[model samples]
Target: SFSGPVTDHAASDDCGVAILGAEPDKFWHDHKGAKVNAIRTRTLISKADIIVVRFGEKYRQWNAAFDAGMASALNIPLIVMHLDEHQHALKEVDAAALATTRTPEQVVQILTYVIKGTLPV
Candidate 1:
């Protein structure tokens, strides 16, 4: 991995989004089932090779820690990037995260190198 060492399971087949696959932000909220999406998100989080939570200033209600907690709960690799001021007090759970970066490009580079064994030129 580009950022740091992670578990072997962090490079599994079930990853969060294959870079350009789908918009991870609002696909669930835009859909019909909130309850179903919660379950699905849980299942996905459980199996994901990595969990990335981008902290932006716009959405006050988006629970980044909840997702981070889920990732930490599953012992999954986590990458957090804070573009805003609110960093919560998750303590050791936050320390357990693989990396906390500022740029999405860094996250992408790390994931690409981890998954594809190459860096973007």
Candidate 2:
């Protein structure tokens, strides 16, 4: 859950977001930890209705790009969030995305609209 009105969306039976990732102890440097993360990623991608990826310098290590690829391969709708500076590096991923947005709020608005047919005011 995303806190605040994210619950409102849930209460209305409109939408809910699951932020998936490794636990703090499951860092990728550990071999067993990496396997666990791979399973988690595969499971989430297989089950997700929509997947959102936010990219940046620090995010490169998180393999957001790899997750985005899985999202595409699974035919799940994808939304990529990144700034203009990174646009060149991410154009191909964005091309595969249903939408490329700038802010977290925009992602929420897009989700709300897609799932409920109600645009943010």
Candidate 3:
């Protein structure tokens, strides 16, 4: 039931991807608790070459805020995809993304550019 911008990107295998918040704790409590999960999350971000910030229709403020902060603090490259066009006006959702996009394809393209060092990512 993957909808929105991730439909195509998830279907393709362009890069090694780490889908943040995709794992549901109710079904698979691998991390055990929030503290462990948070530490694991920081490790993941620190290890990643780039981070993708996908802001959907109903913005998950906590995830967005935390993930974005982690990426910034870790100096990981980031690409932000505002699935909808009006996310910039949200005001409350604050993220210092290197670049902004409206689709998964754009996010991928931006990633490519970042990897190539031709674009600010």
TM for every model, in the order presented, reads 0.59, 0.73, 0.57
Q: Which ten residues in a row have the lowest lDDT in candidate 2?
A: 9-18
lDDT score for candidate 3 against the true structure: 0.57
Each candidate: RMSD to true structure? 11.3, 9.5, 9.2
Highest-scoring model, TM-score: 2
Query: Considering only N, C-alpha and C atoms within 3 Å, which residue pairs clash in candidate 3?
Result: none
Across 1-121, the per-residue lDDT of candidate 3 in tens digits comes to 1112223333322222233344554434333334444555666777777777676666354566678777877777666766455575633333566776777878767766756757544
Residue-level lDDT of model 2, residues 1-121, one tens digit each, is: 3211111323222111123332344233254444545665677677788889888656242478888998898899999999888899888999999999999899989999998999899
Indicate which candidate wins on lDDT: 2
Ranking by lDDT: 2, 1, 3
What residue pairs are clashing in model 2?
none
Candidate 1 residue lDDT tens string, 38-68: 5556877776888887656655224566777
Q: List candidate 3 stretches off by more than 4 Å.
A: 1-32, 84-86, 89-95, 116-121
Report the error of model 3 at residue 29, Å.
Answer: 11
- Candidate 1 positional error at 7, Å: 29
